[model samples]
Target: MTVLLTGCSQGHSPFIPMLGAYFPYWMLCTFIGLLGAFCLRVLLIYWGIDDKLPVPLLFYFAIMLSISLTISLLYFTY
Candidate 1:
């Protein structure tokens, strides 16, 4: 993930060609990240975290981090 983000940050560089070629892979990573986070949330809820607001806050934080990371990676590659 760090490598992808670093590559994305290097705009117009030759390295970006490789990133563009693997756009689908990057997208898949994003999807997987989202899915994993969701599953974690569900597990937390199943363990009784749902009764408190902190659970939602944690979920939101995870989502926000995922989005930011994805965007940062995209920008780095492009």
Candidate 2:
């Protein structure tokens, strides 16, 4: 995703430079999204959303994955 994001821009453009400058910011967003999904899973389990684990994680990951895709799309379009 990083490579795609970076490669989508022309080498000498100001926008490309700014995108490169904030590469870590994108990484941070990815990490935060995954972490948020994990924490939400634990909270849901504590609240008895399910009597077992694993499957609920599928849902969590799906949600987070969609969010990550959205962020990437926004970055791409911007």
Candidate 3:
């Protein structure tokens, strides 16, 4: 049996450079996700609908993951 791999390269860096320093892309994605979650939470709270969520904490977590993964995919994928 044999396995083949293709189109894999080490030419990409997962770090974003700024101010002569580098930050992980994952961290940036998480930050963006957290911000999104915070905004959504605020909107729900303002509408007095936050209490209606079945699982508020889990919902926020899901939202964070969704946002982070979407951003990562959009930014990193070719």
Writing each residue's lDDT as its tens digit, candidate 2 over 1-78 gives 687687546652323234446453456557767877888777877999766665775888887887766765676443
Q: Which ten residues in a row have the lowest lDDT in candidate 1?
A: 10-19
**What residue pairs clash in candidate 2, if any at all?**
none
- Per-residue lDDT of candidate 1, residues 1-78 (tens digit): 677766445344433234447353445556656766777678767998767755687766677568647765776444
TM-score of 3: 0.81
| Alpha carbon lDDT of each predicted model | 0.61, 0.65, 0.87
Better of 2 and 3 by lDDT: 3
Candidate 1, superposed: residue stretches over 4 Å from native = 1-22, 55-58, 61-78
What number of backbone clashes does candidate 3 have, counting pairs of residues 3 or more apart or in separate chains?
0
Error of 2 at 23 (Å): 2.6
Model 1 C-alpha RMSD vs. true structure (Å) is 8.7
Worst 10 residues of 2 by lDDT: 11-20
Q: Judged by TM-score relative to the true structure, which candidate is superior, 1 or 2? A: 2
Residue 32 error, candidate 1, Å: 0.7
- Write model 3 residue lDDT over 1-78, tens digit each, in one string: 123333333456677776789887899899999999999999999999999999999999999999999999999665
Sort by lDDT, best first.
3, 2, 1
